[model samples]
Each structure stands twice: as structure tokens, then as C-alpha cells.
Target: MSAPVRADALATLTAWRPADPGQRALREAFLGFLAARPDSCARSCEPGHLTASALVLDATGDQVLLTLHPRVGAWLQLGGHCESTDATLAGAALREATEESGIEGLTIDPVPLHVDVHPITCSLGVPTRHFDVRFLVRAPAGARETRSEESLDLRWWPLDAPPDHELDDLLAAAQIAR
Candidate 1:
């Protein structure tokens, strides 16, 4: 995107300090990535790029919406890489959540709830790391979700009992946000 957008993302990351030791390490690593690469926020930064994800909770706060990601073949949060139009990392998370969930008027907590860096083999057979900045977003009550092409299925699961994999970070974010 524009220089200012990337700068804003960097500023957001710079301002955050996670309580969890492991998460703090990831955040520090993310700051290093930004310092090393000016284009780190761009999807075209093949070495590794930035992504934004949302741990979305329904209005009642007891349930979470998850997407069974087609490529990853796992139930995961609503999120994707940054776009040219995304002004901030939090905005990117909200856009991805709304687009994937098909729910309107979703509100996001401006501050990030978690940060993670993970490796993935892209569709183009390129290895990349996703420096995912995770935000807590809320969907309106009774909002219906439509399945997007990116997901095998879209469903809401109880926060008290989430899917077996990748629940820890999501649960932690939910708890902290509340």
C-alpha cells in the first residue's frame, strides 16, 4: 500500500507490548522484520510478509466465528494478507472478517490482541511467513454468515469449547478483550 499505511502498521506494532512472554518475543521479531524491510507489509514481499487476522466474537460474547480454511484445511480465524486499500492492520483484520463472515457492521478493538509469525507454503510454491497481527472483532447479534470461497465452511463455536487446534491464542485474545 502507501508509505503511510505501512508506517501506521509499524507504529501499531511498536506501541504494543504483550503480557505473554512468547507473544512478546513474536512481537519483537515482528518489529525486527519491519525495521529490516520497508516492504514487509506488502503481500509481494515473498521472503515473508505481513498479515492481519481477527478473533471474532459474536455480540453475546460467548461464541466465536471460525472458517474452515480451504488451503490450510483447518478451522481458523477470519483473516488474510494486507491489501493496497488497507489503511491499518486493524482495518485489514476487520475487512477480512467482514468479507469472510458476510456479516455487516462488525466492530474491531483498535489495539491488537495477539501477534504471531508462522511459515506457510504459498499457492505459488513459495515459502513465506505470515507476521499476523490479530485483533478482536465483534459481530452483530443474530448476524448470519455466508460461506466464502476461501472457506470450506463457516460456523460459530462456543468460546468455552472451541475446536481442538489453534484455540489457545484465540481464547486468550477473547479473554483479554473482554
Candidate 2:
């Protein structure tokens, strides 16, 4: 297994702000879900574990930054597993955004926008349930693009008419939610 990422480093990502009502409600619901089934991680959601991620919206609020996922061949948000280094789930999401998107100076909300529990296929072929904590992020105004090896491609698309053809069901759901 790879070395776990650090939480304190993740915490240094960005500042936080009060979450909106909708976001707070979502967070509460997610927490409740976790509380109800304490062993969901090791049992129901085995193989995969809890994760955090960020969906970066561009300046105009009409487009989002997406990565062309290599394995699934879909355009998706930036995120990864919540490693030991993550200060909090939100911090992990921000760290993922900065590392994967290569976009600097992203402003992130401290609270998650939504928490989704879903199964995803990894390279190993076993279906793993990812307890995904998602946050909304915004890049600096007029920020330029940057690329990383993890992505096949990175681009901004109009939210109104996203490139759905290049996305999978989960990513498509995220697009529609935005």
C-alpha cells in the first residue's frame, strides 16, 4: 500500500467559512448516516473507504474544471482517499483539488457541499464503496490552466451544456447537481 497522506498538510490548504443552509443540512445528513452504521466502512463499504474531493467552479460560475479520468474514461472532479494526513475531510478535498487540478489559489469552503455514498470500480476490478465527501471550490479569477499526470486531459466546460458524452453516470450526476 502507498504511504498515507498527512492530515496536517491537508489542513494548510485553505481557510474556511460558514456553510450555507443547504450545505449544512447535507453535512448533518451525512453525519447521521455515518452514526447509524458505524461499521459501514469496514463492512458494507469494504475494499474502498471514506474519501474527500473538490469540484472546482470557474470564475464566471458557468463552467467547472474537470479531469479526464484515465481508467473510467470520464470527465470528473478532483479528489482522492482521505489519508491519515488529512486534518479533516474538507481539508483532504482541498488538498486533492490543488494536487490534481494544478490550479493554484483555490478558495474552498470548510464544510462539504454534499456527501455521497456510492460504489466505484477501481483498477483491481473489485467494486468499492466510496464514502465521498464533496466540497465546492473556486479558482482565482482569470487563473490559467495546469496539468498533472493523473489526468488524461483537463478543461473547463459550460455548466449549462456540459460535455456529457465524455462522462460516466456518477460524473454526470455531479454535473446535473451543479
Task: Provide TM-scores for the models.
Answer: 0.95, 0.69
How far is 57's C-alpha from truth in model 1 (Å)?
0.3
Clash pairs detected, candidate 1: none
Error of 2 at 64 (Å): 0.4
Cα lDDT of model 2 by residue, 1-178, tens digit? 1123223212322222224454445445455545554443232345555677787888766678888889768787788766555556667788889999888899886655555666787543678777676777888889876878989999997765667754343344345545
Cα lDDT for residue 167, candidate 1: 67
Give candidate 2 misplaced runs (Cα > 4 Å).
1-33, 36-47, 123-125, 165-178
Candidate of highest lDDT: 1
Note each model's CA RMSD in angstroms: 1.2, 6.3
Q: CA lDDT of each candidate?
A: 0.86, 0.64
Count of backbone clashes, every candidate in sequence: 0, 6
